[model samples]
Target chain A: MPQIAISADSYAAQFAAVKRTAPLAGPLASLRDDAFHCFDRLGFPTTRLEEWRFTNIAPIVEVPFQAPAASGGLDREVLDALPLPRSGAPEFVFVNGSFSPDLSDPSGLPPGVRVRSLAASAAGGAGGLDVLTAHLGRLARFQNHAFTALNTAFLRDGAVIEVDGGVVSERPIHLLFASSSAPAPVLSQPRVLIVAGAGSEVRIVESHAGAGDVPYLSNAVTEVSAADHAVVDHYTVVRQADAAYHVGNLAVRLGRASNFSSHTITAGGAIVRNEAGVVLGGEGGECTLNGLYLGNGRQLVDNQTTIDHAMPHCDSHELYKGILDGRSRAVFNGKIIVRLDAQKTDAKQSNKALLLSEDAQITTKPQLEIFADDVKCTHGATIGQLDPDALFYLRSRALSKAQARQLLIHAFAADLLGHIKVEAIRRGLDALLLERLPMSGE
Target chain B: MLEIRDLQAGAGERRILNGIDLVVNPGEVHAVMGPNGSGKSTLAGALAGRDGIEVTGGSATFKGQDLLDLDPEVRAREGLFLAFQYPVEIPGVNNAYLLKAALNEVRKHRGEPELDAMDFMTLARKRMSLLDMDDALLNRPVNDGFSGGEKKRNEIFQLAVLEPSLAILDETDSGLDIDALKTVAAGVNAMRSPERSLIVVTHYQRLLHYIVPDFVHVLYRGRIVKSGGKELALELEEKGYGWLDAEPAAATA
Candidate 1:
C-alpha cells in the first residue's frame, strides 16, 4: 500500500493495532483489509480536495486516537441525565463504541423486528448477518471518502435493525452512542445498518453525545435500504462535547415508489461534518432531506449533501438552515444530480444562514447538475442577519430588543422543525434550541 | 398627558424635525396637519423613541416622564404607542401571539397580573370583532400577506388591545380606501376615553372628518406656525399648504 504522507505514521500505527485485535474472518475480514488499504492510499483529506475544501481536519489528523477501551462500568446517572424524552421506545445504548446490554432496553418490539448489536451477530454468525452483510457496505462507498473508509476499516460494533415486510412500527427505535472521557484522546467508529422490507414503515432516532468535557473523535457511518413501497423516517442528533470532533456519513437507497426522509440536527461540537448521500434507485421514489445546525463559541459545522436521481419520475426536496453566533463558522454544500435517463425528475434545494454577530461567518453552495431536458431542478442559498424592520416592529410591540432577536431566530428555525413528525423528538429539539439561543446585549 | 417643547430630531446629517412644539391633554384629539416633508412622521417617531431619529434638541415628556430617554419597548411599557405609517411585515410570528405578548409586557410593567393564553384570546377576539377583522388574521404571521387596508386595520386593532395612554396615529390614513378608512377611524374612536389622548398626524383633512380632532395645528418648516380649532384643518385643506409657506417667516418671527 502506498503510504500517503498526511498523518501517515499515526494512522499506520492505529491501523496495525486494529488489525491485530479485530476479531474477523472470511469475507468480513477481507472487507476490513480492503477498506484499510483504501484508507492507507487516500489518507486524511486536506483543503486542496474540493469535497474537503471548506472544513479543515488538521486537529483530527494530528492527534493519535487509539480505539477506545471497553467501557468498564455503566453509569446510570449519566444516561438518565441526558435531555432526551422518556417515550417508552426501545433504546440501544453504546458506550465507548461497545454495546452495553444493561443500559439497553429491547422490550416491546414487535415480531419480525430485530434490534441487536452488529458485533454480537457477526461473532455468532447469526441469521441476520446475511442481511447485514448484504447491505452494510453496499450503499456507502469508501472510494472518495477518507472518513468513511476509516470507519469501515474499524467497524466492529454498531446497531443493526431490520423490519419485516408489511410491518409498521408504532414506536421509534432510539440508538444512543455516548463517549466517555479517556486518559488519552480516542477514536470510535460506530456503524449502523438498517433495512426495511417491502411495504414496511419505521422510524429511527440516532444520537451521538459525549459524557463530559472529554475530547474524542467519533467517525460514524449509517447505511439504509428502503425496499419497494417502504417508508422510513430517520433523525440523527449530534450533540458532541465542546472539545469533540465528529464526522458522520449517511447513505440511503430508495426502491420503487418508496419514500425516505432524514433530518440531521447538529447542535454541539468543536468541529463537525455531516455528509449525506441519497440515491433514488427506482421509479416514483421520493426523498426529503432537512437539517439544522446551531453553532456558538468557536464551533465549526459543515453539512454536505448529494441527491442522485437515478430513475424517472422521482422527486427530492432539501432544506438546511444554520444559526451562527460568536465567532463560529458554518458551511453548506448541496448537490442535486439528475441522470440522463431520469426524465420528469423534480428536485429543489435551499440553504439559509442567519448570522447573529459580525464575526460569525457562513459559506453556502447549492449546485444542480441536470442531464435530462425534461427535468425540473432549482437551488438557491441565502445568508443574512435579522431584518432590522422586523426587529423594530417587534420592539414596538413591547418585546425587548433581545427578546425580539430571539423570537426572529426561533422563527427562522421553526420552518425546519415543522418537518419532524415525531412529537417527542420535535419537542425535545425545540426546547434544546430555545435554550441554546445566545443572550443578546441590551 | 403628552408635551413636546422645541423638539428637534433628524436622521443622520439631514434634520427632519426642527424646533417643533405641541401639547395634548387627556380626552382630546389633536390633529397636526402639514404638507409632505413637513416632519409629521418625524414627530411621531420622536414620541415613540424610534432608533436613528436622534433628538438633537429639546425634550418630550409623556405622563411626566422623559419619553426620549427610554428604549422603544420601555416607552411602550409606559403607555406610549405610535401607529407606524408603514406597518412592518414580520413573517412566522403569529398575530395573536404578538399581541398577547405585548399586552402581558405592559401589564407586567404596571405590576398587574398578566393574562393567560385563554384570557388573552378571549380579549383579542372581542377587539377583532370590534374592528370587523376576520378570525383567520390572528393565526397568520403578523401583517404577513395581509392587504394594505388589512395591515392598517390590524395596527388599529393592536392599539385597541394595548390601550396606550397616548396614541400617535402617524399617517394611519395614508393608504386606505374610503370603506377601510372608516373602519380604522371607528376603531380609533372606540378607544377614545377621558383618560386617554390621541395625536392624529395626517396630510389630508378627509380622515379628520371621521375622528374629528378637538384642536388642529398647521406645522410648516419644522414649526407649528398656526394653531386653531378644528376649522384650521378645513382652512388648510381648502387653500392648500402653499399659503402657509409664504407666511411661515411672519409666524416664526
Candidate 2:
C-alpha cells in the first residue's frame, strides 16, 4: 500500500478521518474509500504532472483552507454587481456552500422538478444522499484526481435538481455560486446532482462569482444523469475575481438516445480548472461540449474534457476556443475514448486559441483512443494569432486598427459562442468576450 | 489624379516593377495588359501601401499627395482603393457593417455627417441593386463562403460605398464567368465618372469589351513595352506576347 502523505493539522486530520468514516454507508462505501485513498496518495497536483504542467495548483493545496464559517450578512451592494440574467425570474443562489432561499426564487418550477439543497436533501429521508454517495467518489476514483476527493471530504450545501420524465420547462433554471467574505481563506464545496428522467428536457445556466478581495477556494462537483431520450442544455460561466481559486468537475451520464450539450465560459480566477466528463453508457446518445475561455493578467484557466463511449452508435463533438492575453496562460486537454463494444461511435474534437500578445501562451492537447474498428473519431488543436490579412482588409474599410482587431477576434470566438442554446447567456458571454479583448470601447 | 514616376517595387528579393512611369487623369480609364508575373498586381498593392512589398526607389502621387507615405487606411480615407484579385474571406464580420464603417470613415475624413443605420442600409441596398447583388450578401460575414462572382460583386459594392477617386482594379475579372464578367464590367462602368480615375489590370481583354479603356499599355519584363489607343489590346491578343519579345530595348527607346 502506498504511504499516505497526511498533513498534521487538525482540519486535515479530521478530513482524513472523515475519509475513513464512511459518512453515509451504502453500496458506495467501498467506492468512497478507494477515491479517498487515491486522493491521499496523490494529494493536490503540482506542475510535475503532465496534465497540471501549465497550471500550478500548489497555491490552492499547500495552504490549509478552513471550512467556510456561517455566512456573514452578504453585501447588498455586491449582489447588485453580479451579471445576472435579466429575464430569468426564478433563480437559485448558493453562497459559501449554503443555498440562500431568500436570494433564490423557485416559485415557477414545474411540478416534479425537484430543486433542493444538498444539505436539505441529505437530512430529508428519501435516500437522497444515497444517489450522491453512489456518484460522489466515482469520478475521483476513475480519474484519481485530488481536488474531487477534497470536495467529497468537505462536502457542503449545493443544489440537487431532479427533472421528471417527459416534462419540458419553459424558463431556464439559473444556478448562482457565490463566495462570501470570510475572516480567513475559506474552502467551499458545492455539489449538484441533476437527474433528468426519461424523455425530459431542461436548460441550466450556472455561474460562479466570488465576493470580497480576500483569497478563497471553491471546489465543486456536479453529476448529471440523462435518462433515455432525455435532453440537457447546461451553460456555465466563471467570472473574474482577483483573489479566488476555483476547481470544478462536471460528470454527465447519458442513457440511450439522450442528448447533452454544455457551454463553459471562463473569464477570471487566479487559478481555475474545469473538468467535463461525458459517459455514453447507453447506445445512440449524443453529446456536444462547446467552451470559450478568456484569460488575462497572471490568471491561469485549464479545461479538461473526457468523452467515454461505452456503447454503440454514440456521437460527441467538442469545440473549445480561447483568447489569452496579458501574460496569462491557458491549457485545453480533451480526450475521447471509444471502447471495443462502442462500435459506430462518431466523435470529433477541436481546440483553437488566439494569442493577442507575445507574452500570452496556450497549450492544447486533443487525444483520441479507439478500440472499435468501425468507429470514426478525429481530434485537432491549433493555437495562433489574429489573421493579419483579415485585419488589413478590415482596416482598409476605414475601421481603425483597434476596431479591425476587435471584429476579427470577436468573429474568431463567435464560432463556439454561436452554439450556445441560451440566447441571454450567449449574449452575456459575448459581452464578456468583448470586455476581455482590447476592443474599442475598453 | 494619380502619377507614378520611375516607380521601382519588389516583393521579397525579386523586383517585379522597374522604372515604370504612368499617369491617370481624372475620368480616364487606363488598361494595363500583361502576361503572368508582369508586376501589374504589385503596382496596385504598392499604390495602396501594403506591407512587405518594398518601394526601393521613385514615388507615387495621388491627388497631389504622396500616396506611398500614407498607411493603407489613411490612403483609403484619401480616396485610394485597391480591388484585390482574390478578396479575403473575413468570417463573422457582416458585409453591411463593414461597408458602413468604411463609408463613415471616409465621410468623417471629408468632414461629412455620418449616416444613420437606416440611411446607410438604404444606400447599401441601392448600391446592391446597382451591382445586381442579393440582400443575403449584405447580411453574411464578409466574403465568407462566397462564390467567385459574389466576391467580385462585393468588391464593386465596396467601390460604390467608398467612392474612391483612384480605383486600381487588379485582375478583377480573373475568376469571373461570362455572365459574372458582364455584371462586374457594368458595375465598374456605372461607378466611372469625371471625378474617378481607374487603372484596370488584366491579362485577357474580354473585360475591356464592356468597360472600354481610353488608353492601353502592354507591360513586359518589369516595364511598359508598348502604349497605344484601345486597339492596342486587340493587337496584343491577335499576336501573343511572343511578338513583343522580339523588339529590343534599344529599338523601343
Candidate 3:
C-alpha cells in the first residue's frame, strides 16, 4: 500500500500521555499495548488499500490532534439543549470521550440489566470488569482497520450495556457523545460494547454531536453481540459540526435465530465515514442494515458495510439512500459474503441516491459473493435525479416546482425512515431532515 | 372557456399537433376522438405543459389568459386540470396527502382559506364515495401498486376533489371495463356545470354514449378531420376511421 507520511511522532506522544494518565494494570492494559503497536505500525490507511479506495483519511492523518482532555466547566445548558428525543429512556452522556455523571440519567433501569460507563466498569472491581474484558475488543477486529486500532489504543471511556438472559427492557437506551471545542484540534475515541443475552431484547440509540464550529475528530467503535433468540435494535445518528471530522465503526455478531438491525443516520459533518459489519455466525440468524445520509455544501459522507452469512438459513437485507446537494459527495459500498456452507442464505442489498444539484456526486457499489448454489442474492444501485414524469404529475395537481421536489425527495427517504421503530427518534429525524432540505432560494 | 387556434406542437423534431384548431365555451363538453398515434394524447400533453412537447406555433387561450406562457402548476392554479392517460405512480407519497397539498395550493390561489386535516378528509371522503372509490386507496401511496382501472378511477376522483374550471380527460376510458367506464362517465357528468367545461379525449366511441359530449371532433394526423354532434361518434364507430381518411379534404371542410 502506498503510505502517506503521517506524523508518527505526534501520535506516539499523544499515546504516551494517555497511557501515563490512565494506566490499566492487567489484561486490558496489554490489549491497549497490542493495539497501540498495531496502530503504530499501520499508521493511517491510504487510498491504495482496496477497502479504502473510495474514502481517503489523509485529512484525518494530517491534522495535528491531541487526545481530548477531561472537559472542565461542563456546559450543562448546551448538553441539555441538544436535539435528542426525550423518550423517557435512560441516557448516558459523554463529553470529550469521558462520561459525565451529572449529565447522565441511568436510573429506573430494569432488573438484571447493567448500563454504566466503561471506565466505571473497569474501576468497579471484578464482576463488571469481567464483562468488559470478555467482549470489549472481541467483535470489533482492529487488525486491518487502522482507525479501529487507533481508537482501541486510546479507548478510555464509553458505554457498556449488558442485558441479562430472558429480560427484554421496555425502555430504549440512549448514549450521547458531545464534543466541545479546544485550543488545539481534539481527537476523541469513544468505545461501546453491547451484549444481549439469550431471549433478551433491547434498543439502543447512539448519537455523536459537536458543540461548536471548532475542528475536531471523533473516532468511535461499537461492538454488539446478540445471543441465540435475542433481538437488538441499534441506531447511530452522527450530527457533527461543519468543521469536524467523524469516523465510526459498528461490528455486530449474531447467534442462532437472533435478530439484529442497525440504522445509521448521518446528516452533518464536513468529512464523515461510517463502516458497519455484521456477521451471521449461527443458523437462522437475520440482520438488517439501513442507512440514510444527507450531504450538502461540500460535505462528504461515506458508508461501507459488509454482511457475512457464515451459516445456512440466514438472511440479510440492506438498503442505503443518500441525498446530495450543493457540490457534495457521497459513497456507498455494500458487500455480502455467503460462505460455502451457507445454503438458503437470502440476501438483498440496494443503494439509491438522489442528486439534486448538477455538481453533487455519488459513487455506489453493491458487491455480493455467494459460494452456495442454493443461495438467493440480489444487489442493485441506482443514481438519478428526480423523475420528471412524477414531478410533472405533482405539478399538474397544483404543487409548485419547489413543493413537488421537496415532496418527492421526502418520499424517497420515507421508506428508510419507516424502519425506525422508535417513534420519538423517527419523528425527530423526520423534522430534522425536512428542516435541512435545501431551500429553493439557494 | 378555452380556445386553441392553429396550435402546432411536437416532441423532438417530429411534428405531432399540426395546426390544430378548437374552441369550447362554458357549460360545453367536447370530445376529441382519434385512432392510436393520431396526436390526441399530444394535444392533451401540450395543453398540460408537459416537458419536451414544444409549442412550435399558434396560441392556446384559457379564460382570456395565455395558457402557453404559464407554468403547469400556474395553469392548474388558474383552474385547468388534465386527467392523465396513464397516471404516474409516486411510491411513499400518500394519495390523501398529495390531494390535500394540491387542494390547499389551488385554494390559496383562489383567495380561499386552506382546509385543515379534518375538513379536507371529510371533503375527500365525500368525493370518494361519489366516485365509488374505496376509502383504503386514499391512505395508500399515489397510484403505487394500483391496478390500471384503479388508476383511472383515481384521476376522476382527483377531478372531483380539485373541481377545476376546465377539465381535460385524455384517454381516461382506455383501460376501463364497461362498468368502470360507466362509473367514470357518471362521475364526469356529475361535475358538469354552467361555469365549467370539459374536454373528453377518447379513442373509442363507447364513452360518448355515457357522458354525451356536445361536440365530437376526430383528430387524425395532427389535424381535426371531422367535427359534428354526438352522432358523429356513432357514425365514426359504425363506418370506421377509414371513411374519414378516404375523404380527408371533404371531411375537414
Q: What DockQ results do all the predictions give, each relative to the true complex?
A: 0.73, 0.64, 0.84
Q: Which pairs of residues collide in model 2?
A: none
Q: What digit string (tens of lDDT, one per residue) describes model 2 on residues A1-442?
A: 1112433243466565554542544434455455556566666776788878878776666555777654424665676586654345568888877788877788789987878887676665676776566555554443467877767655546888888899997678988888865677777777788889999999898888777777788888888988999999998878746688889899999999999999898877888889999999999999999999887777888999999999999999999999888888899999999999999999999999989889888988887888999988988889899988887777667777887877787889877877877787778766765544522101
Error of 2 at A187 (Å): 2.2
Q: How well is candidate 3 docked (DockQ)?
A: 0.84
In angstroms, the error of model 2 at B175 is 1.8
What overall lDDT goes with each candidate model?
A: 0.87, 0.82, 0.89
TM-score of chain A of each: 0.95, 0.90, 0.96
Which candidate gets the maximum lDDT versus the true structure? 3
Off by over 4 Å in 3: A1-6, A72-74, A80-86, A432-442, B251-253
DockQ of candidate 2? 0.64
Candidate 1 regions with alpha-carbon error over 4 angstroms: A1-8, A19-22, A71-73, A83-86, A124-126, A438-442, B246-253
Q: Pick the candidate with the highest DockQ.
A: 3
- On lDDT, the stronger of 1 and 3 is 3
Sorted by DockQ (best first), the order is: 3, 1, 2
